[model samples]
Target: MSLLSVLRAELAFGMTPLLDMASISVLEGERIGFIGRNGSGKSSLLAAMAGRLALDGGEVRRRDGLRVVLVEQEPALPLAASLRASLAARGGLRAADLEGDDWRSTARLQEFLQRFDLDGAIDPQQCSGGERKRAALALAFASQADILLLDEPTNHLDLDGIETLENLLIDEQRGQRAAIIITHDRRFLDRVATRIIELDRGALQSYPGNFAAYESRKALAMQSEALERRRFDRFWTQEEAWIRKGVEARRTRNEGRVRRLERLRAQREQRRERLGSVSMGVAPGERSGRMVAELEGVSKSFGVRAIVRDLSLRLMRGDRLALIGPNGAGKSTLLKLILGQIAPDAGTVRGGTRREIAFFDQQREALDPDKTLIETISPGSDWIEIGSSRKHVIAYLGEFLFPPRRTEAPVRTLSGGERNRLLLARLFARPANLLVLDEPTNDLDMETLELLEATLADYEGTLLLVSHDRRFLDNLATQCLVAEGNGLWKEYVGGYSDWLRQRAPPPRAEPTAAAEQDGEDGAGRQARPLAQRAAKLGFNERRELESLPGLIASLEQELAAMQERMARADYHRQGPEQIRSDRARSQQIEVLLEEKLRRWVELDARRPA
Candidate 1:
């Protein structure tokens, strides 16, 4: 039986339809992902399902005795409560409810804290945004709701927290709990969801399979829609001409034919309206110099607690660096220091000779609430002048999917996602050679996130980004900077996964014969043999390791040449036969590059200290 069903629901704001005649049914034990663009009624739909929002016209039916919990993007918790106390309070379980004399409660709380990396026993009120998210997630999971509705639950979470949540949702031991997750996180969706449902034009439709499948289907659908739109345009243009001729002929019999043409034109307009487009414009800019930004012995501290210490890093043109760490590890602070928002206590910060950097903060707090979209994009110029006599503000707003009517709306009225889009539009409108983004994927739709990824990939500049979106990091980051103990920063040669693999615990060493002899003799005999082994690479492997870098560099140059040749190939002039050959060659090049890159990374990591 279906756990929940929405029948012909209609939700609107003023005269705008947020959702119209949307009906959906979710079965027990189903893991569904709710996806849509920003301001596309995803959150509203979830709210309606959870019965937190009134539906204008529809009925929500739930199975008898089913318990539902809706977790919002920003969870609410009492400010005074400690992390442990808050969890217990929201979980509605007394110490006795847990098995064994309060020990179980304590153990469970400690486990949750440790798993989330909040092991310090800090007050909940003192926790960072990411920590708060973890606490809320712990409480939500403990609730054991039969049906869970999550709206952007991963927004403030770090990579570790996100992984934890994914594991919790996918655990079979959790029983028959179903979930409706509204998220822009493609990776999270891929990991946790079994079904994909898209919200479009106030209606819901299920796409068979997971997030990846949905993306493939969505791309095909978009291409088909584009072709249909072109055909519709041609027909409408021809029919309009015919209707004009009939009206000029002054024939009474032609009146009915003209009316039919008018109806046809209206239908064409509706079809056009259904086609979604985001007008992103990339402004041209001078190429950045070799060095984008540099930091040497950078350190930051507050009240003797050093957040970032002795950090040294360099960003170059065409570099995509992902800054990663647990909450309060000073990932954002590093960005701020680089951007000159905060001054480091000790170190030198430098930028390229012609650097033009743009920073996108986590909250998008740079956007002004008192201003309109048009004003925000072009503050000093008249709308008419900037837009080439048609109001550039409107054009800019339109690029971010903001309607013409909403151009004059106050920024305060915009949703979090809308604000993010607007901020992006503003940033892209201005030329910059270096981009410093802090959590750019937060509040963004999946489509927008993909668009951003593609844009950054194609961008001929430097990018320093901090994001918990694993897919984004995988596709974009060429290097990684992990914040570690005592404000130390470690640079990894490759991406996030590479960092994880390298940081994994090394194999346990077997005790040496001398150590065993010492133990047998009841004396601490020889640390010398163990110390000597640690000081030197095993004699058999030392020479080969020294030559690995040179070998890897040679292979890399060949791979680069192959890539360049493929890029230069003229596929447009190729016949079907040639096209097949060209595709095969491209795939071969890609595989070779991947193989060489992996080998190079492995060789580099094995280098002697």
Candidate 2:
């Protein structure tokens, strides 16, 4: 039997049709991803399936004795209840009801909490945003529902938390349990989705395979449609010319036919025009100086506790920096200091003169929840009235995957991912020479995230980003700044993977005379001053470390040579075996070049003044 099925479902919110004759069947162990633009009825359809929103027509069916659970974008856990109490209230295994009288339920809850890196559950009332979401997810997992519905499950989850959720879903899939996940996270969809179902115009359409397949299909469909339109246009032009050139009697006889043809052409044109493009425009700005921001001896302290200390760094133009560390490790504090939002206890913080800056904070608190989407997009406009600007609003929201009808909806009514997309839509609508983004990808869908990444990759500004999304950082960041223990900050000159390699504790150092002389044979070796080693290294070692420029130039030469060889191999009419060998050789060269590039990064990191 099917785990769940919706047949000819029809639902509406007041005058708006939320779902119109939408039919879908989900079987046991099937993992489906529900995708659509903001306000595209994804949530409404989920609600209808869960029996929270009554269907106007048709019916929903489920297997006998099957339990269903729905998790919303903004998880609704009772804030006043303790974590343990909340879990117990959710009808899960209780501590007192567990066999062996071992507090197994409590232990399980603790295990999940620790797995998500959440701290002690003192007064769940005061839990952080991320913590609350984690707690809610834990309750859902503990409930052991047969059919699980997750809406934007990755919202507010860090990279580690997202990975944990992915692993949980994979485990469930392996166990033959079914799930329907509504998310904009492309990476998550790529990892977990077995199939994708898009909710468009209150109708459901299933795409076989994963999110990537859906995208490829959509692109191909659009291209085919474009080709068909061009063909129709050519035919229509010829027909119109023939009609205009015809004798008077012939024209009179064919007037009705021409009118009918005109109507058909108009209908086709309308259909073609309905597939709107994602348009985005950034205002022109003056180029920033080589150094966008600089910090020297910077320290921030709250009362007696230090958050950041003695941090010194320089942000150059075109530098894309990712700030990473554990929660509450002062990543945000460091950003605030850079933005001058808070004064440092001691140090010099400088930014390039005349540099224009834009920031997208973690919470996106800059957006007013009470405001309508149209109002948010064009605030205090005299010429473009709220209702009159529907076309403009639709055009603008299209870029962020929001529909025209959602422009008048209150921001408060939008989902987490919707709000995040709106904030980004607004951010990109403007232009700046420097951008400071904190967790920009938190609530965005995979498609939107890819668009944002593409936009940023082409952005000609300095970027200081704080994100837990490894893929986002790997794709966009050219440098990394880690907020480490004891208010310390370390900067690496490469991307996330490069930073990880550098951070891997340097291979155990061999015992030396200095180690024995300083009585630092074992534990004391770690205590040895790094300054002493720097002092001991000779000028040649320093020069070797500083040879990054030369190495980079040499790598560039090798890369160019490899490209030339690949081009020759492609153009030459060699046998299939020789062609295959050439391709393999080219790939080997590319791999070597990548390794050398990483080595250049390491050398750059060790450069002396």
Candidate 3:
């Protein structure tokens, strides 16, 4: 049964058309992942479906008495109200109603707040961005709504928060509730979405299953579409040549052919070309000394809280390092210490010679909102130098997906993603041997994010990154410096996934009183599990470690085969029970593989030096 339908939706922004004869029917139990380029009116579409915005033409139909809730990109909460009161108002619960015997509503509210680690009595305005987002989500989930419209729900969330959301949505799919979510988190979509819907050129294209399935089908469809367009153009060109013939040939032209040619001309005029990918490149500066920075027994603290203690690290040239941790984990403080921007309390910080640095701050304080795009990139002069090449400011902005007309527009007029792109455009124009980016993937589209990844992979200079995006870290980081709580940092050999497999689980008991005393004195205690696992493996443990590789490989093979089957165009045509069983088995394999990998790492770490 269809819960909602958008019938021939026609919407426009001023003179530009955002949606043209677009239509889609959202059915029951459907978790749809909505994807598109930045500024493609995805948010507007969600608003229209939720009945918050009226369409210029066409209509939105909803099932009778169906409740729908929308979580905006920047959710607003009453400034004067506490978090609990804000959520209660959203659920339409008055003071008397909450005080009555409504156990279910009260339980639901407590469940979400506890799951999100939010204190209900706190002021909404005092919460951080991620906390605010969680509160908004909690409000939506506690409602009686059957459908949810989420816009960039993962923007400020950390890795753990993203996983929590994924699990919630997957559980929700088992119920009758449905959702239409707009996000750029690829891994989240892979784990949660039951279907994928793309908004391209003001039209909706539906594909069955997750993001991987859509990627495969979209590639083949684009190829076929391109071939057909080429053939059409060829025929159109022949008709144009015949119509341009001299007077004698024109008189002999068939009347039917002439009418058909006129129709083709109109079709060509109305065609909307697809936008191109972002073209990005880095300009390398003069080579620097091999060593970038080195820290010797560094310790930094703020008031009574220790941020970094007894930490030593050497950063070399050409190293791509990622700093991974939750928000407020001292990642920024560590980065500043490495860059020699601040003095350490009790250690030495050394800088490399001949190093030129370019930093992309997450706050984007470098961009002036009052300045035009042209002025921001190249003030006064129209031409800017990129390494050895010189290009006009307008053309440079074009490479970053900004149109010529918007070149003179102020920076404040651009959206969040656009502002990030503009920052990249400015960041890349300068020559630097060291690049430091803080949360660079926060608001980027998938296409732009992938392009940025590729560009960074090809860079010859050193890179120091801080981000909560697991996939981005997995793709680019050569090593990760993870926060191990209490100002202790550990270095993992690979990216975020590697850290997950190698990290020691939390201690089962509280630290000894002596250990706690030492921690308070700036000496953080290592977890007991690491010490317990340091001994040599026994015979049974050795045998188990030896068998892990074969078992892991077999499980991987099985999972790959299942994925290949699921990616087939006719995969959804199978019996519903069979599809469910296969999906269940695939998930089981993933869990088994993670366990095997963790065991292997643990045993290997126990081996003799």
**Over the stretch 351-398, how does candidate 2's per-residue lDDT look in tens digits?**
776688877877778988899988887776522222223336557676
lDDT, residue 195, model 1: 91
Give the poorly placed runs of model 2, Cα more than 4 Å off. Answer: 14-16, 79-81, 92-107, 119-121, 224-275, 303-306, 369-418, 429-431, 497-502, 505-609
lDDT of 1 by residue, 1-609 (tens): 688999999898886687778899888778899998777788888888877899989899998888887878877666433667655656665534443545755576666667666743468777767777777766666565788888888988877788888887888324578889988887677667889999887778798766766765665675677688888778778877876564564578777777777798678654415535565645546787898778899888988889888888888888988988977788887887876678889998887777777778777778889998878888777553321234467765776788899988889999888888888887777678888888888898876877787678777778888999887887689999998778888998777766876775645566677676676344334443333333345554565566656665765666576556655647346554444344334334433445455554554455454
lDDT of 3 by residue, 1-609 (tens): 899999999999987778888999999889999998898889999999999999989899999999999999988876546788777776667745555556688778778888877888898879988998998888888777899999999988877788878878888667788999999887677778889999998898999887766766676677678888899899999999987874243455577788888999999988888898899999879998999999999999999888998899989999989998777889999999999999999999999999999999998999999999999999999999999999999999999999999999999999999999999999999999999999898789888987898799879999999987776787689899988778888888888878886898764775677766765344334544454536678999989988989998999999999989987989889974566467546645665676688788888878665
Q: For model 3, where is the 10-residue window of minimal lDDT?
A: 520-529
Question: Regarding TM-score, does 2 or 3 come out ahead?
Answer: 3
- Could you say which candidate leads in TM-score? 3
Query: Number of the top candidate by lDDT?
Result: 3
- Model 2, position 595, has a per-residue lDDT of 55
Candidate 2: TM-score?
0.70
TM-score of every candidate: 0.74, 0.70, 0.84
Clashing residue pairs in candidate 1 are 387-392
Where is the poorest 10-residue window by lDDT in model 2? Answer: 382-391
Give candidate 3's TM-score: 0.84
Q: What is the lDDT of candidate 2?
A: 0.72
Give the per-residue Cα lDDT of candidate 3 at 147: 95
C-alpha RMSD between model 1 and the true structure: 9.2
